[model samples]
Target: MMFGQTPVTHVGVDPFNPPNPDVWPATMAPVQQILREGLDLGPVTVFVGENGSGKSTLVEGIAMAYGVNSEGGSTGAMHHSRTTESDLHSGLKLTRNPGSSKYGYFLRAETMHGFFTYLADNPSMGRPDSDYHGMSHGESFLELILNRFRGGGLWILDEPESALSFSGCLSLLSVLTQLVDGGDSQVILSTHSPMLASLPGADIYEVGPWGLRPNVWEDLELVRNWRSFMDAPQRFLKYI
Candidate 1:
C-alpha cells in the first residue's frame, strides 16, 4: 500500500525441480523450510537471525527474483566479481503488486566495495564529484543512500549495519523511515542490529531452526541478549 506499485506481496519457494542432492546437501538447510508457508510482505520488512541462518541468502534470492544483480546494484548495473549466490533465486517465487517498480536497488554491504570499484572503473555510470573510493566506508555508504536512492523504489539491503556506526545506524533509520513514509518505496532488510530492526511499524521476522516467523522487537534474541549484557556485563563476564 505504501508503494503505489504493489510491493512484493508474497514470497515462497518455487517448489519445482527439486535441487540436486549431491550439490545441495540435506544437512544444509534450505530457505524453503522457512518459507514453505509463503511470506506476506509489508511496506517495511526486516529479517533477523544469527550467522549462517540464511537471512542473507534469502534476501539475495528475493533481490534476484526482482531482477537485481546477484552481487548488488540495480538490474542495469550488472557486475559479477564472484558466483557465490545460492540457487534459491531460481526456486523462489515472488508475487508483486499490480504496478511495476519505477526504481530498485540491491545494496549488499559485503559487496559494496567491489561494486564501488566497478563504478569507479566505469565512469559512464555517472561518477560523483567526490570519488566514493576516497571516502570512508560509512561515509560512502551514507552518500549512496542520500544520493543514489531516489525514493519511489524498492530497496533491499543485507547487513547494512556492518559499515555503520551506532549514530550512523540511527541516521540510516531516519532516512529509511522518511523514504517509506513520504516516498512510494518498499524496503526489505536482513540485519543483526536490533536498532535497525526497530523501524517503528516494520514487520520483523526471525529466521531460526523454526524458520521465519513474525516476531516482536522486544522479543528478538539480539535485543534480549544485548539488554542482558548491557544490564550486567559483569554477570556474563563472570561466567567466562
Candidate 2:
C-alpha cells in the first residue's frame, strides 16, 4: 500500500469491550469522551488543560496504541522503567490512515531522562549516540528533536514545555512546522504552553471535567489564565 499523508486519523474504543468506567483512566473525562466519541485528528493536534485534567493520559494512550514506547521513545523501542502508564491503550482502537508511515515517537517530559539513558545504550545504526545526558534539560530536548525527528510520521508529546524555556518552545514549534510542511507528518501534543497550542494548522482541544472539546487558542482556559496572570500577577498573588 502506498503511504498516506496522515498517520492515525481517529482514536476510539470498541463499545462491545469498552474500558470499565470503574478503572482509573476510564474514570477521567477525556478518556470517557474518547470511549463514547472517537477523536478526529488533523496534521497537528494540541490538547490543553490544567494539571490532572487527563490530557497527558489521553495523549499517552493514543501514542501507546499507535505502538510507540510508553516510556518515551520511537516505535518498537524497548525503553521501560517503572510503569505509571494507564491501561487505556490496552483496548484502544486506532483508526490509522490506509497507508501512512507506521513509524512514530513518543516524547513524554517526565520520562525523558530514562529515554536518554535508553538511547545511549542503544545507538542507531553505525553512529554512536550523542551525549544527551551531558546537555542541560532544554538543550537535550532541542537536540533530540533536531537529531531524531526527521521524516514523515507521528510525533506525540506530553507536556514538553516542562523541559523547555520560552525560546525552546519556539524552536520546537519550528521543527514541528517543518515536519507538517512536508505533508506526511502528524503531531499530537498535550501541553500547558499557550505557545504550543498556537501551532499553525493544529486542531486544539480543551480537556477538562466536561470532557475534551474542540477549542480555539484565545478561548482556552489555559491561555486565559496565562493572560490574566501576565496582565496582573498582583491580582492572583494577593491571595497568598
Candidate 3:
C-alpha cells in the first residue's frame, strides 16, 4: 500500500469450510454466493438491501478483514465494548490492489457514540480538540469524515442514513465523490436510502434472497419502492 489507500479488489469466505454453516450470514444466499465467488469491489460501491439480507454482515466482514475495528473506527482502533458481530470476519479474505492503501476506516452509525468515546479517551497528538459528542449526529459524521478521510484509503460505511438528513446525505455524497476522484481512494457503502444509493459514478448492488446482483440506481427495487411510497403515501399508509 502506498502510504494511504486501501482498495480491496476481492472478498470472500471459504465455500467448503465456512466459519459456521448454521450461522446467519452463512445461511444467506448473497453471502453464500460470496463464499462461492468472492465479491469484487469498485472505486465506489453501493449495496441496497432489505433488512436481514446479510448486506451489513458482508460489509462488516469486509471491513474487519481489511483490519478496520469491528465496533467502528480506523484500522488501528481497539474500541471494543461487546462482541455482537458474527464470526464472518474470522473466515473472510481480502485481496487488495497492489500498492494501494492498506489502512482504512469503518463508520457505522449505530456505533458512533462508542467510537466518539474512544476518540475522546485516546486523543491524537498535535490536533485541535473537537467534541464530537457535543455536535448533532449529522454534524459529527460530516466533521469526522472531513478530518479523518483525506489523501487516500478505503472508507466503509454501514447505514449512515440513520444519522443523516437528505442534505446531510448529499454532503456525505460530495465528500465521498471527492475522495474517489482523488485517484487513490475508494468507498463501499450499504444503505436502505435511495438517495445514498443514487451516488454518482457508484456501482450499485441489490442484495436479497436472489443474492447480490448489479443494477442501475433507477432500476433498483429499493428506488422503486421508495418512489411508489412517495407517490402514494396513502397506498402504504392505509395498510398500516
- Best candidate, TM-score-wise? 2
* Candidate order by decreasing lDDT: 2, 3, 1
As for candidate 3, its clashing pairs are 5-101, 6-101
Predicted model with the maximum lDDT: 2
Local distance difference test, each candidate: 0.80, 0.89, 0.85
lDDT of 3 by residue, 78-134 (tens): 899988887788788887889887779999999999889889888877565479999
- The TM-score values for the models, in the order shown, are 0.90, 0.96, 0.93
Candidates sorted by TM-score, best first: 2, 3, 1
**What is the clash count for each candidate, in the order shown?**
1, 1, 2
lDDT of 1 by residue, 9-88 (tens): 88876667544445542124546563446688878999999998778888888898888888878767778898988876
User: Considering lDDT, which of the candidate structures 2 and 3 is the better prediction for this target?
Assistant: 2
Indicate the worst ten consecutive residues by lDDT in candidate 2: 1-10
User: Lowest lDDT 10-mer window, candidate 3?
Assistant: 1-10
